[model samples]
Target chain A: MSDLASKSVTPGRDASASAATGYRPSRTLPIVAEIRRQASRRRTQLALGFMVLLPLIILVAFEFGGGNGDDDSNGGGAFSSLVDLATSGGLNFALFCLAVSAGFLLVVVFALFAGDTVASEASWGSLRYLLAIPVPRARLLAVKLVVALGYAFLALFLLAGTGLLVGTLRYGWHPLGSTIAAQIPPGQGVLRLLGILAYLAVILLVVAGLAFLLSVLTDAALGAVGGAVLLWILSSILDQITALGSIRNALPTHYSDAWMGLLSTPVQTEDLAKGAISAIIYAVIFWGVAFFRFTRKDITS
Target chain B: MYKRQLQIVVATSDQAFLTPAAPATYTVAIDGQLTLPTLVGTPIASPAAIYWYVLGALLAVVLLGLAVLLLVRRARRRRRVTAVNAELAETPLVVTGLRKAYKDGFVAVEEIGFTVERGQVVGLLGPNGAGKTTTLRVLMGLTTPTAGEIHVFGHRLVPGAQILSRVGALVEGPGFLPHLTGHQNLEAYWRATGRPWEDARFDEALEIAGLGSSVHRRTKNYSHGMRQRLAIAQAMLGLPELLVLDEPTDGLDPPQIAEMRRVLQRYATDGRAVLVSSHLLAEVEQTCTHAVVVNKGRIVASGPVGDIVGESPSVTIDVTDVPAATEILTGLGVRSVTPDGATGLIVDMNGTPRAELVASLVRAGVGVDRVVPRRRLEDAFLALVGDNSRGSGDR
Candidate 1:
């Protein structure tokens, strides 16, 4: 101990020699690393697990409950009609799953993944370390955003893919009985499912963007996810108010079901185009705010 | 023939050449060297000219905005460069007039100025809420300072600055992914740093941690002391030049604390620097080569450990019949007398000689068992921050 203390405070070495060798800020927090980190979390596993399980649960219910055998063509609108045709084929069941889950289930899942990405790190007290690692703030956010979106897209695919598999085994591989088309060929039906999946991925960007914004704004993971989901629900509620007239058209959820146009014979493009455009615009705005806020945030957490 | 290479530039001032009445093309010559088309295209009508004028104006506005943005960025970069170049010598860390005020106008660190030289373990000592942590936060770029500048390795520090790669820090507390194993957490952190795996000095850090096989166990089940040790090891990763740890010994047992003291001392060797903040005086006295004492966002005293400890002119006296010894010492007009232990009495020497006090004690029939100078950092710390110690506000 005395020998250690006897050493003078001026050990001879170059000042710059202590800088850690081979560090480049741009290379920090790569997208693959971020994906691996997030993927390892239990929440991510559970979310994707639930998505795969939901369709099986629905299939089991259909098998036991027998679909309420009232074949009188009740005309319960487009959604119920789609549900009625779910057992007809694998394609129809996949479409039914997409239609049912697109509104809320997919929204919540996407919001949870994107919202929890940053806020969870903050709550865990690791964000400051990342920032101090000198991971350029913009690169950090960009990588996390990419990974979150990737996971959200995976969740969508799992839901529809599981539904198709289960439905094919339970029923059979038959053409879809769409509302407008007399019978959609199995090949065309699968193509249309892919198209609908692409559209859902695009439309859900607004939820992901809003959740990402809230995640940057708050350290509480639940608050970020729940706040975004609540705001979406509020927009959905406000979209239901017909008395609001043309103003309701500006609502984020107004064109949420626009992918239904894909089920028509000629595949109506009008509402689908409007939905894609509006969703992109809203997503850009929310993402812009998130980037602007995050770059300047103090990150006290 | 224009001698100046017949520059056919579209001059905005030549309005007549662009008039609708003007011919589609015209030729001009100067000095008979060359002939060039003065008006190369059909003249634009008024409405078309207005449209072109609007487009030109929009393009000009965009160009001007881009130029302004570039200028601002250049100015910021220039300021940083100037700050870096102005340094006389490159120290591990140098902070000047650093101040930070929260959004609600509560000033956490009012004005702090200090330097951590290489090969020195400098301790930032203060009472609770005396702005020790706040100062460290600003230095780490975790919190922006409302005023002042921080320079590391002759580079002005900013959020996500590349110069931070040279420093390792564990500010406020340890932060780790609870779900990951200790080794995995350290690996993830180092990977996030984008530094080479070999530079992480994993074997050395893990040895310091002494977690043994527990390093492979998930962090969630680990105790607080385990996490603290892991965090300190994390900071030591890459063996950065400047290590800043806040309360590095908060959760350690006595043995671990003792080990930590040696680690910090050895780490600070070879031209590396360390800055640790702790309210524990003994920890700083034992570990740090130099100390900076802060009280209420201000430096009260700062110097080598011996100098600061020497400021308190006091002595601890071991005596039989402490009451009689105290009476003798007080009657001698020393500033104050306080009990140390059962047989120890601490007397503020007040510039009075130890021999004089002892002589009086013996004359009064009080057995003077022993007399030793009070050199504990605690005495110096209290002497420096004693008056307004309780007034140190919340951070």
Candidate 2:
């Protein structure tokens, strides 16, 4: 404590020094603190619960439908639908899981994790107090963005890791031969799977940033999450319309499925590269907007 | 389906393998529904043009980011300059010609300036739309000033300014997350400050809030009064040097209000200053040592509560024989004599002294039970704020 930390109503001696010395607030909210605040909430648990249950539900559905192996689409599983890839080894099945979930379910998961982070605080009327707690306005949003993205990436990892574990146990860990590059070593195979997982994580950062930006714009947590999901759905719809020309590429959903290129014989690297670069560019833009708007916002809530 | 298209290509390829010299001109139809824009004449877009478009978009976003960064930097620079230039000596707060014109062009506060020194319990009194809340908002750095300046703890008050650590504020009303327990809300709030939890006088604040075991329960179950107390406790964390409360007693019962009054008095005892805004005039009069009266975005009167409510000509007299006193007072040529009831009357003594009225009453054998000045805070506030400055209130 400083000498000026007195109870007298009059300004303390060396008042400026006392005031300056006493209140050196940290620039960021601790990751642990943020996790505590987020983990205790119902939405976080609900999202996790849904994520854990998804693999089991898909497993049941596949068990009921696995008898239909008489279909002729078997060899095309690498570049084709997940339904064709189901009977493959654990690696292919997990990849199939990522393929299916990356469309909307994982988008919802990203929206829930990152999108609900900041806006929920604002909706609950805690944002004003956080800023008033002497957390610099920019720092408040920055801390939230970090924690939100952290959770988002963690959720993706968990989903994929869970699928990997369950698929390995249910099936056998055979080499992913067709798409695994001709006669590749076992270590390289694991590396390729990790590489694809990493690629997906990077591209999904665009959604994380988008949801976070929406979180800053709207006070309602559900609105932010739903709005991001809506935009993703809109992008997917637009992507389907070949008439959109290159304009559909501007939509956030455009590059979402670009990870499929990793399954090609020679590994079509162009689409994967474009997707990663575009995602990074879009993510940077979204986060930029978030920081700018949040710092200047009136925060009436 | 693309699969059907591929199957035709495959069958033709198999036949070509069987007959090496066979000539085949296969008609293959690709999926037409693509966004790449190459199926028809006058193609405006293509997959080849995508990289350029993405680059152009990235450039636009980068430029926007730069612009916003420059603006934020300029604001920060200006705040630093103001803080350095400020001379906030011997006062916890000082406002010099502060003005705030909201984006909607509502001049909520205009050139309203005052100093809150130590050991002062200053009441900010105003009617609806008189700008009391706006003034506090500006002072707390929650809103920016348009053309004036504010210094708290001898540093410029601006958004993200660190001097805010020395001051605690509960503006408008108590806002808390209902899902969190009162204690949890306070805990989260303190942690958000980035200050160590040890610096938080949690026990002291809890005692002040008087939530007791309810502090452990969620604030969602709290009554309006409990919420207010919790807010007060949140503001009191670390026992900040300056406390700015808006309508602190608004939701409190009489007993709670009384306890809050004592808490405020004790808060200011050790040289800490408090600025409280209240609509309740009697409460302000009873609780505050000094007052600043505002009306229509301007300060009308400010000084000690006693000075603002100084002796007025009107006096409420309680007497044993009201009619007899009224008759005598009417004959004595008082300005106006309105009978309050059977026991007393309110007399507007137009320059007549209370001593003279008492002597006259005694001469006439009317027993005067009590005599008190009618200098009420309500009257003082209404008089200071004026008659026509009411209504069209802003929310």
The runs of at least 3 residues in candidate 2 whose Cα sits more than 4 Å from the true structure, single-residue gaps closed, are A1-14, A18-22, A25-28, A64-66, A69-80, A177-186, B1-82, B85-87, B316-348, B354-372, B384-395
User: What lDDT tens digits, residue by residue, belong to model 2 across residues A169-231?
Assistant: 787675554433453334565666777888888777777888899999998889888988888
**Weakest 10 consecutive residues, lDDT, candidate 1 chain A?**
A1-10
Write one digit per residue (lDDT tens) for candidate 2, span B1-395: 01112222334436646765777586666678434445553543546456546656776877887689768776865557444433665577888898878888878887798889988999988877778887877766667778887787667777777778788889877777677899998997777666767878787888878888999999889998899998998998877878999999978899988888888987876668999998667878888999988777888788999987777788888888888889999998999988765787888899899999999998999999889887755556545644445532344
TM-score of 1: 0.82
Candidate 2 local Cα displacement, residue B46, angstroms: 17
Residue B224 error, candidate 1, Å: 0.3
What are the clash counts of all predictions, listed in order?
3, 11
TM-score list, all predictions = 0.82, 0.80
Enumerate the candidates' DockQ scores in order: 0.20, 0.26
Lowest summed lDDT window (length 10), candidate 1 chain B: B1-10
Give lDDT: candidate 2, residue B17.
60
Point out where model 1 deviates above 4 Å: A1-19, A67-75, B1-83, B86-89, B316-350, B362-372, B376-380, B383-395
